[model samples]
Target: MDIQVVHRPGNSAAKLTLDAGESVTAEAGAMIAMSADVGITTTTHKRGSGSLTKTVKRWFAGESLFLNHFESRRAGSEVWLGTPLPGDMTSMTLQRESLIVQGGSFVACESGVEVGVGWQGFRTLLSGESLFWVKLQGTGKVLLNSFGAIYEQPVDGELIVDTGHIVAFNETLQFTLTKAGGSWLHSILGGEGLVCKFRGKGTVWCQSNNQRSFGTALTPTLRARSR
Candidate 1:
């Protein structure tokens, strides 16, 4: 399987070229186009599985309740996928590695990869986003989309990142949610909110823009709907 990301950094899409018998699983409604011969199956969990518990957890994480499995019947078959936001997409290969992805950032992954949910305890609830994270493991290629341009940050020790900007991080790193300023009052008054402090050595992927901040900025301009 070959994955190519096109229109990078803005309005990005992924074009996947698959050989015969190759399959990929993606979030529901992620498929934009695919070859006629490509077979598609929708399920509550990964292909050939009936795990309703996982599906419900994913829904709470802001992901689709179902997953779509695409299989190529013929060589050189192709499939295109896009995200709802206008931003960038990236592909990563996991060699028996584990990744903790921010909810809603997942796009697709090869069949060999396993997708599950990770509970980050009650602290994540204060991040102003979902408390659950999408966890990926196994050896395969994974695709992720972000609300803005994505960049990789190599953390040798510790790094502080706004919670809303993180796309994903290596499982080797431990993160804790904390106030951005020295005190809670300062954090609230300064408008910095909460931030995720990543510790240990690993890589952290972050989006250039924060969707929460963007939405907040637009709130004042958008007239409230009449009830």
Candidate 2:
């Protein structure tokens, strides 16, 4: 399958074009447009679009967990899509031809195959691995956007990452959120309360700009309304 990210950084929308007969499945509400022959399906989720015809197998909103899949049959098929969640969903995992994304932040894998997880799940995935277990497959790229200036340290013994700034870390490192600074008073006053601590050795990807706390064109209106 051939794919390309037509839009650069800072754009409101990113386009993914697939070669003829190539198909890909992603979460629902992520598709912008597709060819007429393209097939759209949802799993136990509510879907609606004025531009495209939709069919529901089993529909649920808040309680029912749903995932969407789309496939195209003709070459030069294009889909304009973006993340449906807000900026809080900072991490995502793509594995086994499927993607698991958090509730905040927009995410897309231009091309590749891999699994991804957020700060919580990433710590769980790394709890058992030794320092040497961190691995990066053939040209697999994981994109993570944060809320503040992200910090990183090589995992030799322990590393700390801010809750809002953490993007993604290798599964080989064990992580937990602990109070930074000396005491509770210091932590609160210093403006550095809880930090994601990593123990073991692995690579951590962080963002220079905090995408979670900030706003983007893709940011949800509901979240903006809350603030």
Candidate 3:
């Protein structure tokens, strides 16, 4: 299968080309278009025959409870998939190790890639976001979507990223979530509330804008309009 991303940095969409009898799995409601030769099916079909329990885990992880599967009856059939968020979509090829993603940022993944929830300690509450992370394991192509431009940086030693701006990272990297500055007062006044300090060697992906912050900022205007 071949995938191409279009309308980058804004309303991005994915165009996938499939070989005969080949199949691809994606998040429900992500399909924008598909060729007539492609057959569509939806199921909680997790590998290893994991059925209901596996589907529940994916739901808790913020993915669709049932994944949409598209198969090509003839060679060279194509499909288009899109994200609900107006931002960038990124795709990565994964091996044995898993990629831990902010639950809402997951768009889809090819079959063979497992999706589950990673529970975090209460310490993550200080980050101003939920504690559950979508853990994507196995070997397949994973598509991640974000609320802004996606920037990827390779970390060798240590790196600091705004907690709300981080999209995903390699599970191999060790990270600590803490206040951004010296003290509580400084952290609160500095405008940078929480940051994730990542150590070891791996890649980190950050969004240019924080969707939560954007929503917070827009609430007032929306309320006024509603009134």
Candidate 4:
């Protein structure tokens, strides 16, 4: 299978090409278009699993409880996947490695990749992120979508990132939630709030824009419409 990203940094889409007997698993409602020969199956869990517990965990990770699996019955079949937000999409091939994705960043993955929920503890909840994150591990291509342009930051020692701007990161790094400023009050007053402090050796993928910031910017307009 081959994955191509179209339209680049803004309003990007993932076009996946599959050969006969190949399959891909994706977040529910991610399929925008597909070949007629491709078959889609919706299940509460991954392809062959039926554990409701996993479904509930995925919900906590800000993903659909049900997942969609697309299979190509014939050669040269293709599927287009998109995200709810207008932004960039990228793919990575994992060779027996694990990736920790922020909630709502996942787009799709090859059938060989295992998708599960990773608990980040109460500290993450206070940092304005979901306590549960999507964990992908295995040997296949995994696609991720961001709210804006995506960039990779390699961390050999430590790095500080705004909690709201993260897309995903390598599991080799350890992250802690801390104030952006020296104190919590100063952090809040500075409009930065909590930030993620990643320590260790790995790469962190971040979005150029923050989804919460975008929503906050439009709050007045939405309120005025309701009024």
RMSD of each: 1.0, 9.6, 2.3, 1.4
lDDT of each: 0.92, 0.44, 0.84, 0.91
Q: Let me know the TM-score candidate 1 reaches against the reference structure.
A: 0.97
Q: How far is candidate 4 from the true structure (C-alpha RMSD, Å)?
A: 1.4
TM-score, candidate 3, is 0.90
lDDT string, candidate 1, 48-103, tens digits:
55478888888888999989999999999999999999999999999999999999
| Top candidate (lDDT) | 1
Give the per-residue lDDT digits (tens) of candidate 3, residues 1-227: 78899999898998888889878877789899989879888788553445686677667656778777888898899999898888999999999889999867877777768877777777877777656687889998888898889999899999999888889999989999877889979998998888899999999999999888899898878746544
Location of the lowest summed lDDT over 10 successive residues in candidate 1:
46-55
- After superposition of all CA atoms, the RMSD between model 2 and the true structure is 9.6
- Please give the clash total of every predicted structure, in order: 0, 12, 0, 0
**Stretches of model 3 off by over 4 angstroms after superposition:** 45-54, 224-227
Worst 10 residues of 2 by lDDT: 54-63
Alpha-carbon error at 98 in model 4, in Å?
0.6
- Residues 66-107 of candidate 2 have per-residue lDDT tens digits of 445456677777766654333222323434333222223323
Please estimate how well model 2 matches the true structure, expressed as its whole-model Cα lDDT: 0.44
If both were scored by lDDT, which would come out higher, candidate 1 or candidate 4? 1
- Per-residue lDDT for 126 in model 4? 86
In model 4, residue pairs whose N, Cα or C atoms come closer than 3 Å (at least 3 residues apart or on different chains), thus clashing, are none
lDDT (Cα, tens digit) per residue for candidate 4, span 101-198: 99899989998899988888888888777778999989999999999999999999999999999999999999998889988899999989999999
